[model samples]
Target chain A: MGKGILVVLSGPSGAGKGTICKAFLERNKSVRLSISCTTRAPREGEVDGVNYFFTEKEEFEKMIKEDKFLEYANVYGNFYGTPKSYVEETLNSGYDIILEIDTQGALNIKESFSDGVFIFVMPPSLDELKSRIIGRGTETEETLNKRFSSAADEIKLAEKYNYAVLNDTVENAVSKIESIITAEKCKINRIKDHMDVLQEV
Target chain B: MGKGILVVLSGPSGAGKGTICKAFLERNKSVRLSISCTTRAPREGEVDGVNYFFTEKEEFEKMIKEDKFLEYANVYGNFYGTPKSYVEETLNSGYDIILEIDTQGALNIKESFSDGVFIFVMPPSLDELKSRIIGRGTETEETLNKRFSSAADEIKLAEKYNYAVLNDTVENAVSKIESIITAEKCKINRIKDHMDVLQEV
Candidate 1:
């Protein structure tokens, strides 16, 4: 079996990246969602190793010192990180892993895993992005303005991604992502081993 | 409208490149089949401009001299060439064009159009390729051996292609090609203008 693709899915907050990722996971049974390591307390029903490998702050900091995390960030005060070993094991086992992260985290992952597929989900328009953020019903006017401005800035980073998929609908976005994965598998760089075997034949 | 992709479909003689290209064109309404210009007389049912733009030998040579043909070759005394303008016009109009050519022709086109999506179709195995060639019922034992050896040599050049698709089945191969085209459209390099427009918004 071939090594699995490490897909880093990112976009602005209101671009439906989460919904698209969820739908893509639902459609593709072979792909796994990369579980993160966090120092924050688990929510009511979150399971260790499933939702996250919840750890104490000291242990998380130790892992950071060991360079065990592919990427990590301190949100507010809690630390959340993608464990490098877990991602490496999943890909080595020939199971694709999707990491839905912010643009900053995605760029950090790029440094460690240059072969990873970076995809940026795009909102149909700025106005639509505003409506989606407002539809969440939790953002204060000030926070909403701040988020909208941040999203606009993040959209500028889309050009850095290997591919940018428009989140016009969950189904369409999932299909496009599926196509990207399929095409990446067929890329010549990924098939060198297979080519060697063919040559021997 | 975004620019269309120029898909170069090539493979060994018995790799089913033609079948896959035909199936892809049948399924994708937006893609056009690139017609070749040839000095050979048209077959009984073949239509001009549809099957080929049949031209006199002098005209074909003049085109070669003028550098109007993207790639051309003399095959068994008959000249066949791909018209560069027809491909450019189709792509400029935002319609993808599928060029079903041989490996040499494809590599030649690459020198001129490096951005073209180069896809090499592969038969399941060398044995299967030989069987397929024999199945065509046109080769004698001697000619079969020659064709089979040539196919083996051609397979080695597949590494030069951007993608190598196994023609285990025509349906599957066409679907993979479809995915490749879809994914190529999402490539960041192809969407620079779209990105500029989004940034402006």
Candidate 2:
């Protein structure tokens, strides 16, 4: 077996990245989502390792200092990060991993893992994005406007990604991501070992 | 519609490139095979425009002189070439085109069309390749050995391709090619117009 692929999925908040990732995971059993380490407390029904490897703030901070995180950020006085060891081990063990992160985190991860497949999920339009965010009903008009502009700014960064998948529908988006993974596996660089074996034959 | 992709499929003669291309086209109705211009007489059941675009030797030489062919070669006193204009027009019209050619022709096409998706197909094993060639029952023992060595030489060039797919089965090869086409469509560089439209939104 070959070393598995690392797919970094990123986009704006309301671009249906989460939904697409979930649907993709459901369809692709061989791929596993990278479990993030967080300082935030686990909510109801959330398993310790399955949902997140919840840790204390002190440990999370120590991890940051050790450069153990692929990318980390302090959100609402709580820490969230992707543990580099976990992802590396999974990939080395021949298990594809998907990291669904925001634009900033994805870019940060790129610096350390340039080989990862960076995919940017996109909303169909700004109006569609606004409607989706508004559907959450958890933001005031002021906050909504701020998030809208931030999302627009994020969309501009999609150019930095290797592929931009428009989230017109969860099914379509998931299918496209699946295709990306399939194509990546077929890439010449990725199948060097296979080629070598064939050469020997 | 977005511009169509030019997929250049190449491999050794016994690597099942032709079978995979035919299977892929059967499933993918939108993609058309690029018709080659040849000076050879059309065999029984060969259509002028479908199987090949038969032309006079002088006409083919004129096209070669005008640099109208993407790639051309003379074999056994017969000339064959890919028409550059037809490929460009098909892509401009947003219909994907597949070019099934040998390794030399594919590399030649690459010089002029670097944006094309170049895929190198491989048999499961060289022994399998030998058996496949033998199955054809056309070559003598001396010619078989020569062809086998030539195939080995060609396999070495697979590294130059963007993707290398093992033709373990026709279905698997066709599916992988389809995935490649789907993934190529999602490439960031190819979707510049889509990005521009989304930016305005």
DockQ, per-model, please? 0.58, 0.61
Segments of candidate 1 deviating more than 4 angstroms: A39-51, A75-78, A139-145, A195-197, B40-48, B139-143, B195-197
Q: Model 2, residue A193: displacement in angstroms?
A: 1.9
Please give the lDDT score at residue B129 for candidate 1.
Answer: 86
Clashing pairs in 1: none
Give lDDT tens digits, candidate 1, residues B3-47. Answer: 789999998888888788888888998789999898987766779
Fnat per predicted structure, each in turn: 0.49, 0.51
lDDT of each: 0.87, 0.87
Error of 2 at A54 (Å): 3.9
Give the TM-score of chain B in candidate 2.
Answer: 0.90
Interface RMSD of each: 2.1, 1.8
